[model samples]
Target chain A: MNIPMPDFMPALPEMFLLGMTCVILLLDLFLTERSRVVTYLLAQSTLLGALLLTIMLYDNSRTLTFSDTFVLDPMGSVLKGAIYIATFFVFLYSKGYLRARNMFKGEFYILGLFGVLGMNVLVSAHSLITVYLGLELLSLSMYAMVALQRDSVVASEAAMKYFVLGAMASAMLLYGMSMLYGMTGSLDLTHINQVTAAVGSGQQVVLAFALVFIIVGVAFKLGAVPFHMWLPDVYHGAPTAVTLYLSTAPKLAAFAMMMRLLVDGLGGLHAEWQGILVLLAVASLALGNLVAIAQSNIKRMLAYSAISHIGFLLLGVLSGTAAGYAASMFYAITYVVMTLGGFGMVVLMSRAGFEADRIEDFKGLNERSPWFAFMMLILMFSMTGVPPLLGFWAKLAVIEALLGAGGLTWLAVVAVIFSVVGAFYYLRVVKTMYFDKADAGAAAIESTLELRVMLSANGLAVLALGIYPGTLMALCATALSH
Target chain B: MSFEQILFYVFSAITVLAAGMVITVRNPVHAAMFLVLTFFSSAALWMLLEAEFLAIVLVLVYVGAVMVLFLFVVMMLDLNTTLLREGFARYLPLGILVAVLIAVIMGLAVGQNHFGLAQVAAPAPHAASYSNTQQLGELLYTTYVYPFEIAAVILLVAIVAAIALTLRRRPNTKHQRVDQQVATRREDRVRLVSMTAEERK
Candidate 1:
């Protein structure tokens, strides 16, 4: 067979970031401790440059490149933009935390930039091979980031656990992809969709098996129940700065992976996969919310909360409609914002020698700094899906999607109940901030003006978006339409 | 049975036996040797199927390079064989049950339905001059070039991750600082004066 040359235009942003990351990696080696800020600046500029390129190459229509392995689409563009903005905030918040812990090094920024590049590729992947490569790249970076603090035994243990579990999940995904390839005789997702759609009963068994494996892999990444064993430990053990990075941007890439695999490639097998997703979603909601209530550590609590939020995300995907997909996209973006704010507070409250991981750290936060406490309140309230916050709209959109799906109304009710149960912990945080008295010797929050400003903007954005989520929702809908 | 069919059975038997020994062996070094044997037998099996490139790669990359690394690691690690084997008997029942279950499932899935020779005929033998490696390389660099590049990137990430995770800077270790060295001045280090000499007496 004659081979066709691959086009690289659609991958311009990825190419740009890849080149920049290498330069930054080498540039960071020569940087002194005081000059590490240069690395941070370069990393940020890399992200900005990528964002600009993505915008310049933006089109509402989908375009396939690199032999149809990579794709450029409106959904990817929107998600890439969201990931960049989230990473920008994460970097800004992490700088002080890193410096305080003597973990201020070029490695964090370089690895982080690499992770962002991975996310960008994941967002644009159109084939199984691309998806696996991007996911591995991201996983490796995350495992390194989690263990960046070499002196911390806990961090090392956490990194080992994350690495092992993540490798297994990647294997499961590859196994599933291999099975799908066997059944369809093609690795291209579109071709697989066509083959799956045309398969007879005999092939359906293999397809079902593949779907089970793929969903297991996806659930592991989402930290859904049963596969969520590693999430809380990694979250609690890593430095607060890494936890902040972990919680915010990676979810967007994971969401993109789900969309590409489930909605784009395996849409033909929806009837089968949706059943599996429904079970996972309900289990995640029940387990995530219930377990989170028992956690006294804020990081662990948010880890469980991330699990439950993933349930909500799956609820949107299981709706099996364009509108449902759009709603999930919207929820994913909003959840990232909420994550930045929630973990930003953890980073803010932490000092050089003190870790603000305990639930009690937020006691009388209002008494300390009313402005930030209110921001914290907004984040917690939004997470609990309280009214007039962006989190509310996010949940409402998913619930609306489920209701629109007709038969899934009962699942919606179960989700709402779990969210209500989930609300208790978040409100307890709010109560601690507002009602409890601050300890006389509690360390004061040492924060930069940039963090305070960005965090406030992040917090208020939730409230602002909640009150009026029209534009963003419309954008999500538009991205999903084509 | 034909001579070729008898040879096939021999290679298959060796591959299976060696693979079984890989997991069941007590000594880590023995396990590594068993794995190498398994890889060689599998390469022979692949050669029987006319997949010359894959057979050579299995021997060259896996048995030659990867197995050597495994053997080195096994030697370097101070592992207690008795301690490692302590819990094996206790877990044997559960392991056997799962293994049997998997065997039965495979029997039904691949054995009964998919593996019928009538369903999948053996390929005709290639001409003696046919170079599987050339065709494989052409496909890898041309048609599958996207995946090829991606695989390269994954390896790059692996290198970065391995180094970043394992490399540590010990705070107590003495290392020259270029900036400190460059900024050093004679006055800051020496501090000599006539009054100081009188005070010393």
Candidate 2:
């Protein structure tokens, strides 16, 4: 006659973050500009505190609560922990940059914190409705964040583009989800998977149509080629602080969404959606690598690079194997680290008048400061998939997963070639930093000791992980194995 | 046709006609009014489907509330819609192409090829005693509670974001502050000058 209540323990971290975000929002309203640093502290502590809560609540088994729409699993917890770390760096690096440009406001931090909460929800989503809800929550916050710099025409345009396209994507996803519901008679992924797996070819045509729409929606969110039109413009148009927030953390959420929808929900249609991912992966690799070379703006270049990394990320997913998913997860973590460091450097170089977003801005970084130059070198090299960096192992893991999948070897070759071409652009960055002469009036490197130390450590993590990538990969493997 | 079928066709046809008029009408206010009619007809069609909760909510929310607010906006904006639609002709072919594509795809999606009784068997219809509202409420409060709360957060974000973007403290603007007005006293806003009458000379 009555159902048991859902467990509150699995969702403790999300609950904690949401409460703190509201508290910080109110706290910021009353504080003067001089004490506004408290907001930053509170937001950072919220992330740290959530991370702690997640660690405390971590269990090896999948824990479903809240009507089984939300599932806290090994993957969700690990990915959420990754999101927290990435967002931590985003806020830390954005502090000086936003303050210098007079764009520092409580709204940015509040929205960013909300974005993190959205990503957290996204990572744990277990049902069609939860997935869409999380995606919309994440998307809306990003739209607001992009348009936060309201005075900038470019930013406003970017926000408009992102909003329109994101809404269209959400519609496609909802359409697909409703179709699934109609066909399978359930919105829960576990039930959908069982029904779909048993239905076989009974309704393959409609199922394939639904699959296409879902793939399109997922690809759009992941910024794969063909649906990646808004990524670069949004990245380049947004304030650097916003770009810093946009480029990190959310990738984990998007990745989790992919796994939940494609791998878990529609695993029965692996034959259909696998091919779609292959096409997206190849196109993204070719187009992203080739196009990034022509980009003079560093933000646009990184956006394209994000696309290429997504290509690699898809390689792991499309393999439809535990090893491949783990590889993808490993790749996502490494990419986030490299992107954070890369964008952190961009933010560090920027000051009041100059936006260090142009490729030329990195010229003679060695002359400016050899230590940070070395740091940038490490990040660029890692991005190039050079050996002895975390990125190299990530690429190898995916390529190996492709080989493990037997017929995906050619796709792996395509990925390898694209990586080689990708190296040209990433290495060009390093070359410019080391080879080119500093501008005559180039100012000396200036930043807080804290940013310098954290950034250097960020760079070193890539190298350190490259030397030993087992622990993270094992974590990813275990998360997906169950 | 039976009377119910006849009424269903009438409402659906009106819904389609009004929807088309929403886009083609020259006047923006006319378009808004057309949109309202479209909502009304759609609601009527839903009423025929035995989904009273949805039908009532559609009429109450979309037709009664949203459309009225939309009409007010249209009447207030005084838009130069003729100038705005100048490019409508240029984009008509592309727009038609997309619309046709979507129509065909949607037709296939819900069409007989995939969704008919012959292709996929339909579930048994609900009994007269079944309450769609009760079922929906059970799901919303139990299994879908997470999404319900997330939706609340999203609306909160929307409210915060809209205010953040549009609200500004310009100090230069001439808007009155109610708090300042309420705080004013005899000694504050009115300095009791002893020789105020002499100033007129």
Give the residue spans of candidate 2 off by over 4 A.
Answer: A1-3, A200-202, B76-78, B82-91, B118-135, B179-201
Residues B65-104, candidate 2: write the lDDT tens digits: 9888988888888798778979888999999999999788
Docking class of 1: acceptable
- Score each candidate by Cα lDDT: 0.89, 0.90
Question: In DockQ, how does model 2 score against the reference complex?
Answer: 0.68
Highest DockQ against the true fold, candidate:
2
Model 2, A302-330: lDDT tens per residue? 99999999999999999998899999998
**What DockQ do you compute for every candidate structure?**
0.41, 0.68
Which regions of candidate 1 fall more than 4 Å away from where they truly are? A1-4, B1-8, B82-99, B115-125, B169-201
lDDT of 1 by residue, A195-223 (tens): 89888787577688777788889888888
- i-RMS for every candidate (Å) is 2.1, 1.4
Candidate 2 CAPRI assessment class = medium
